[model samples]
Target: MLFGAKNSSNPRLQLLKDVVLFKDLSMRELAMVDSLMHERRYLADEIIFDEGEEGQGLFVVLSGRVKIARFASPLEMLIELGPGAFFGEVALLDQSVRSAQARALEDVQIAVLFRAEFYSLLETHSAIASRISFQLARVLAARLRQAVANTDRHHEAA
Candidate 1:
């Protein structure tokens, strides 16, 4: 569980400008997104989400840092994202279990978009939805390439 203050004045729209995923969205489009998402805050070292848990939505970092990690023999870090970055996008396409766990490195703020609400937004606003879809696809493609490269490195070492 988590709790914090909510900023009602254009915080979401400003966040849209920070996130590359929403770089193409206009002020009006961002405002629409603002209306659809909810904001939350987490204390430092908080586990935002756990790996293998069902993903319910996407999250945009509004402030502070988050580390994405996976557990095997030991915990392996995937990445650390700061303000302006976003994650959990895979849930938007499919309600798949989360691949990595996210922990806040500092007291953090994030805007969350729930799956049901996002789907409704898509149905109501086709253009913004298309842009988000394209952005997610590109991000996934890049991650896949990185994964393949990492696999090759591990194979060569063995």
Candidate 2:
């Protein structure tokens, strides 16, 4: 199979199911999303995407770990994500510059859902697109709330 056989046991399909963006998708829907995705392997310390680069799309860690970092004066490391975690979701909405860079902490396998491919899927499957878009919004909202809470705590501590 060109994109891996469409079977219940397909690891890629399972990985897609575990991601927040595709969590609501059924097995059949996962297969459709899988079709739009391409796999890439990166070695430890390899850059996946750099901050300020044009955002490509969402990247899900299929295996190993990925580090999301902000390259400021001190180079702050933001988060380390393992299998099934996803990043660069903002690119799905528009091809803006990335705010952070992603690197492989170890040899990693990633599934990339490119913007053009996602748009094509949206046109062909609006229902699926709507579901994913809504989920993305919810995820962002939750993160925003957490950020606000942290800011409030920081202010109180000062």
Candidate 3:
């Protein structure tokens, strides 16, 4: 019901509406966010962004899969994302370098929301921005908790 009474058009809009970070956004607010989006495609195995590179914004997976991995001493894999998933959101709040590398697991399509545009939305649409920011904070906190739990388990095993 959040994406508009279900229609043939706006599949991308519907998909984004279901995504966690965008769920609280209304259809109109989503359209405003959509206006700032630009689509890009990548082939399997292509590097979408490299670890240590500057993160410009959030990358929403529209189609296909993405593999997020790190290049540290252990070279760990962070996550694999599919349609309706998003990453690089921290960059929207803090323009920091990426902590992991993103690669296309297959031919993929993504919608990119640039940082400047996101900030502009935050200024002009505070309500929508607050919803998204709250969601982002929740996700970050959950990830932090998971990491701590994993570390505790590792120590116990050791």
Candidate 4:
């Protein structure tokens, strides 16, 4: 519900620099991306986004913790994200239903990067966008590898 963090005195770019998605960006580039983002705050236990919802963008944690979970009958937790971490990254690339839900584990603040804004960046600043995209691909590939490894371990245990 919040828009850009320009009104706040806090250094948004400082937080942005630590985020993996923008790690390769310069201070100027990070400022450009920061201007495109809207800051949102969540209370403890609030759902940031729900499972099966149409993904629209990715959220980067600025402060506090978040839990990524598959809210099934058994409630399987996927991961816990903290400051400088990002989640819902796949949404930035395509329109798809989220496979997991993201919820605030504590009072949290985050910056959201919408897909439309990102696409515009791709058109106007391909260099910066491509850097982010490359990082995204690496993150996804690493997750895939970890998932496969977990599956193999489960199979061997069974």
Candidate 5:
């Protein structure tokens, strides 16, 4: 099946249930989010976004996989994202350039939300903004905790 082609009654609703960023949203809020986002499909090996490029929005993986890579001194594999995962969130929050490159590892379908649309939606729906802010904070906290844990592990190894 090609990415973004699903048989579900409501693909956006299904996505909301699967993605942490949207899990806290109500049905109405989900519908709002659905309206602001667009679905796109990419073939395997396609470049979703290149590093250092201006990031317009974030992408939620609907199906297939993606690899997040960076080039520092030498090329490095940062991480791989699968279904229900998201990337480019930092750019959404700050409107900065992307810190890494994302490439499709398989035929992939993704839901993308542009910064202007997202901010406009948030302005129109305060509850949706609250929910998204809460989720983003949680994600950031978790990542910080993970970084601390990794640092401790490295220190212990040394």
Candidate 6:
């Protein structure tokens, strides 16, 4: 008999369960959302996406670290994220240019939730979509608040 032949642990499903965007979802609902995800991998120092490119979807880091940077005069490094963290989320709400470039700091695995698929979920599985949207809103709001706090701190130091 083959081990993990009939009952296997799915790594992707396991990763999705811990993601903040799907934290409120039950296992069955996460399985539904998992069905819509696309997976991609990147090597160390690879450009996952570039600044100013049209955003397509949100990417959740499955394994390894990713750096988010703004290619401006000073070349600011926005954030570095690891497993369970999601980025490019604004794309899910609108057709917009990516504000930062994401590059792999190490070998990375990511799961993508495209805008179109998320929209389809909103229409077909409204409850699941609503929960995700709520979580997304909370994440955005917290980021905005943190930005404001950081700006204030910078102003005070200068």
**What is the TM-score of each predicted model, taking all chains together?**
0.88, 0.93, 0.89, 0.92, 0.89, 0.91
Candidate rank order under lDDT: 6, 4, 2, 3, 1, 5
Between candidates 5 and 6, the one scoring higher on lDDT is: 6
What's the ranking of the predictions by TM-score, best on top?
A: 2, 4, 6, 3, 5, 1
Best by TM-score: 2
Question: After superposition, which runs of candidate 1 have C-alpha atoms over 4 Å from their true positions?
Answer: 1-8
Q: Kindly give the stretch of ten consecutive residues in candidate 3 with the minimal lDDT sum.
A: 2-11
lDDT of 4 by residue, 52-121 (tens): 9999998999999999999788999989999999999999999999999999999999999999999999
- Candidate 6 lDDT trough over 10 residues, lowest sum: 1-10
- Candidate 5 has its poorest 10 consecutive residues by lDDT at 1-10
Mark the regions of model 3 whose C-alpha exceeds 4 Å error after superposition: 1-9, 73-75
Q: What is the lDDT of candidate 5?
A: 0.86
Instruction: Please write out the lDDT profile of model 5 over residues 113-136, one tens digit for every residue.
Output: 888887897789878977887898
Q: Tens digits of per-residue lDDT for model 3 on 1-158?
A: 77353333556787788889989888888877777787799999999999999999999999999999999788788889999999998898887999999999999999899989888988898898889889999999999999999999999999
Which regions of candidate 5 fall more than 4 Å away from where they truly are? 1-9
Cα distance off (Å), candidate 6, residue 36? 0.4
TM-score of 3: 0.89
Pick by TM-score: 3 or 5, better one: 3
List, residue by residue over 1-158, the lDDT tens digit for candidate 1.
13423334555677677787788888878788777888889999999999999999999999999999999668999899999999998988898999999999999999898989888988999899889788888989999999999999999999
RMSD of 3: 4.6
lDDT of 6 by residue, 1-158 (tens): 45322113456878888899999999888888887888899999999999999999999999999999998889899899999999999999999999999999999999999999999999999999999999999999999999999999999999
Could you give me the TM-score of model 5 versus the true structure?
0.89
In model 3, what lDDT does residue 144 have? 99
